[model samples]
Target: MGVSSGGPGTGLLDRRVERGAVDRVLDRARAGNSAVLVVHGEPGIGKTVVLDYAVRRASASDLRVVRASGVESELELAYAALHQLCVPFIGPRLEQLPRPQRAALAVAFGLREGPAPDRFLVGLAVLSLLAAAAEDQPLACVVDDAQWLDRASVQCLVFAARRLLAEPIALIFAVRGPGGDPRGVRQLRALPDP
Candidate 1:
């Protein structure tokens, strides 16, 4: 099914079938477990509707939610998605990260001058930052149209997703799929029309 552009509520038609998976993800996050869920389907298959449901549920449960969307035009810009995901959470909490990790993120975000960052280092920095934030409250990071994300952002985010254990954070990606799959992440493919 496709989402309607009229407004909220109007677009989430026929999405009951996807509710269970979203509930499970939210349940895991509430239990202090780290989780990553990828919801993939063909374009206009209501993936955004599912993501919106997750966001609403997470917010209702008091989880801190951070959202970002990848623009096709920004696909060439390194760390663009990561910047969007982490900018609101950046603050004194980032100072708690290991020195090198801190520097890596700063370099990537243009917050300071430094050598080009290692992708893994940046990813670890992201993981640490999310974990640190989670200590204050459970966190949910939502990325829409992840298929359009930059290569570097995808690498870093996937790295962070793989390492999310024992932390109260949930990383969710809504990607245009049915053909493309984000490597090494747990996937929940949406059903195609009959």
Candidate 2:
């Protein structure tokens, strides 16, 4: 089935349908360990819905929530995911990216840049910035439409995923099959078994 069935508010969201798995993830996060749930299927299969439910429940439990979406046409746009994860932390020092890069990141986030710029760094910088911003709270980063995720974005996540246990972050990615990238799935499946 496509991810539409897996999109937000689908049948799998009954809580009774997959509460155990969700609870386990919550438990792990509560214990200060990160959790990754990669749900892959065709478009409209409800993957987003499953993650949405998990995020909502996690939020109710006081865990911080950050949501980011990948657009089908601009996978290479830098810092799209990172900006969404940073919106809750905006301030004077936050807008430090160069004008060009800031504009690119703004488009990536589907927004227009304000007078000040937030230099959206690429690769490892994204992780370091995010970790620094979230130093105070337990955080979860949810990126939907992973199939459209850029190579750099995937690599950034891979770098972050490897160090999740030491950091208070969970990276959850949802992808649509046929349309989903096989290499992405393989990399996700092989995340050091934790």
TM-score versus the correct structure, for each prediction:
0.90, 0.65
User: How many clashing pairs in candidate 2?
Assistant: 25
Cα RMSD to the true fold for all candidates: 3.2, 7.5
Question: Over the full model, what C-alpha lDDT does candidate 2 score relative to the true structure?
Answer: 0.59
In candidate 1, where is summed lDDT lowest over 10 consecutive residues?
Answer: 1-10
- Cα displacement (angstroms), candidate 1, residue 77, comes to 0.6
Q: Model 2, stretches more than 4 Å misplaced? A: 1-18, 90-121, 178-194
lDDT of 2 by residue, 88-146 (tens): 75443236554454454455455774542333333334555456555677777777887
User: How would you encode candidate 1's per-residue C-alpha lDDT over 9-36 as one tens digit per residue?
Assistant: 6456556656677778778988999878
Q: Give the number of the best model, judged by TM-score.
A: 1
- List ranges where model 1 is wrong by over 4 Å: 1-11, 179-184
